[model samples]
Target: MPKSNTIPVVLTIAGSDSGGGAGIQADIKAISATGSYAASVITAITSQNTLGVLDILPIPLAHIESQLDAVFQDLNIVAVKIGMLADADIINLVADKLEQYQPKHIVLDTVMVATSGDLLLKETAIGSLKDRLLPLASIITPNLPEAAALTGLAEPKDAEQIEHMVTAMRQLSTSAVLLKGGHLEASDESDDLLITQNETHRLSTERIRTPNTHGTGCTLSSTIASFLAQGEDMLSAVSHAKQYITQAIGHADLLKVGQGRGPVDHFFMLHQ
Candidate 1:
């Protein structure tokens, strides 16, 4: 194993969630919780809480590029987790930067909508995200809503439907797709499918019943990137990430930060 002091670094390129439940905040927390250093590039800012997003202000493209350059110049960023790029220009800029820096692993959470049903990504940018960013990702984690938007399919309601969506999404040329089934809340179990070019792994767990699932996607993807940065392969990284998210979600009700959907306990281990 690498020296303990040489912790792998994971960079998150995304938006700022002022509520601290999702976006860059969640990414940093999950990365740190999973034993990696975290760096961030905030492409946008959202005034949001567990209730919903009320406003969005996208950062300038030049500044986003500068943040990417600044982080890549010094830190040894082994993996990258990309969340909300709010527009077409931001998507192109991030894709260009990824082309330039060429991080070893890229986990793209196609963040289109929030947990409270607020749209975070511009519909106009979806085409650009597919054309530029999807091809570059090591894996793309799309929940039911995002998968439907990306693949032009209906939102999944079951494990079989989610797998079907993954099959459709693979045509977009992504090397891997982690189709998240968390939004199928009516089911007794959560099924996340990891579909790669050659294999498909079904990862199922008992669904934790709670409204405090805000930031779950960001947390999972960033944690997966962290594990990858720490030298775990794709399947192992995803499996470990699943375990981490389950634990986080199971402990989420312990936090009373919001009146509506609360956040997962990213530092649940510390709280023990």
Candidate 2:
């Protein structure tokens, strides 16, 4: 007899993107595509589209805390992917809840700005995020701009600079760092550096040129968490996630979700 498929539950604690291209929406889509159940705790709600973010409404700390409690109390959550928390209060609240429940895998996407250049995290809350939530993460995934913000280093232009910046970021927390290189200019191939205490690994691939690159960050982090929930080791999980995102980006033109930078096709594998 064949073994049964176990559907591991993965939680995403992030903001709601009304456009359905990024944030909690993208996380759920990517997790579902990877054969995991996605449960969400919304930290904020945004009125936005692929073109840009118009407005944001931060969820109350009390309400956010209740939602976290509700999920942790009932679910056997295997991994947690955390995205935009919006404010200091929300960040603090999530940190407290995660400490209490202590989920096995926590992948933190330090979302500071959107693909459309709209600010997602408040300037004041950056400190709180670094001081409190970062240490709790199992791995912290930051795009170039977000990595610069965290490390107080200028945007790295090459692999050597990126490695140096990653070293600085590692000192901030015990969590492993995945410094994304997609935003680097003039790159022959986009590369991501994953630095853990024991070793550093590089995952590189040709850049898929597509306007539909709206939710790549959200999708990548969520997929990584999903793989971890399915019992893959961290290195294997990140490696698989790189392959998944590359495929999604390659097939991004299939989606016509919005007027501007649409969305990566999270279900691209199903069509093939």
Candidate 3:
């Protein structure tokens, strides 16, 4: 076990992306990049690369429980980032753990499908994610497809339609909803909608044209958790995460990792 210290600790519960661009690998990289210690509890293993996902194997629920128990018992985990829970059972187990540990910051990247058009979560678990896990998160970061899945909004064509989607998601839980517009068909800027219980914020950044946006959602959510673990408020955390991911996407072309869509440069700032 690593020695306990005052350094902020962030925990991630997600799948393992063998490609190392997303899931637990991306979470660790993003958290560490934010100067926070990262611990992980993997819920599934995925055989994937920039091209596509080949297969997915969900971890046993008991093993997932054990990992969560070990971390919460030892580490003062300040924030948790959850991603790619494979089934309803896995989602329930994760929710139970969060209930037990009650970490201060919880960021849920509602990862439904990969950038390569592969489904990450089972169809049967969608209801469970909305009914059980959505309520527990401090915030949920969902791209257009994920938001549509949760809210039954299909494709939100205009700003008013997008607002309707956001309202539907906010109705699910008191937790804040971060509806990401990255998946939308936009020509200029990608805007993100952050809707809290009492406030609504629209954040926009100039879109960096890159094919290396494979794990952008995972990176953003984990980075938000990292900032929250560092004692920043939710609004500040989201803002900083957006800035960090913009820089990462800007540097994506520098790293020649895979044949198809590559990964964002998580440590680009370090190389500067």
Choose the strongest candidate by TM-score: 1
Q: For candidate 3, report its TM-score.
A: 0.96
lDDT scores in order? 0.93, 0.91, 0.90
Ranking by lDDT: 1, 2, 3
TM-score of each predicted structure versus truth: 0.97, 0.96, 0.96
Q: Point out where model 3 deviates above 4 Å.
A: 1-5
lDDT of 3 by residue, 1-272 (tens): 98977889999999999999999999999999988999999999999999999999999989999999999999999999999998999999999889988998889999899999899988889999988888888999998888888877687866677887766876877489888888665547888989986778999998777789989999999999999999898889999999999999899999999999999999998778
Per-residue C-alpha lDDT of model 1 across residues 1-272, encoded as one tens digit per residue: 86557889999999999999999999999999999999999999999988999999999989999999999999999999999999999999899889998999999999999999998888999999999999999999998889899989898877678767767977877899998888888899998889987788989999899989999999999999999999999999999999999999999999888899999999999889
Rank by TM-score, highest first.
Answer: 1, 2, 3
Relative to the unseen true structure, what is the C-alpha lDDT of residue 221 in candidate 2, on a scale of 0 to 100? 99
Model 1 segments beyond 4 Å from truth? Answer: 1-4
Query: Where does candidate 2 clash, by residue pair?
Result: none
| Clashes by residue pair, model 1 | none
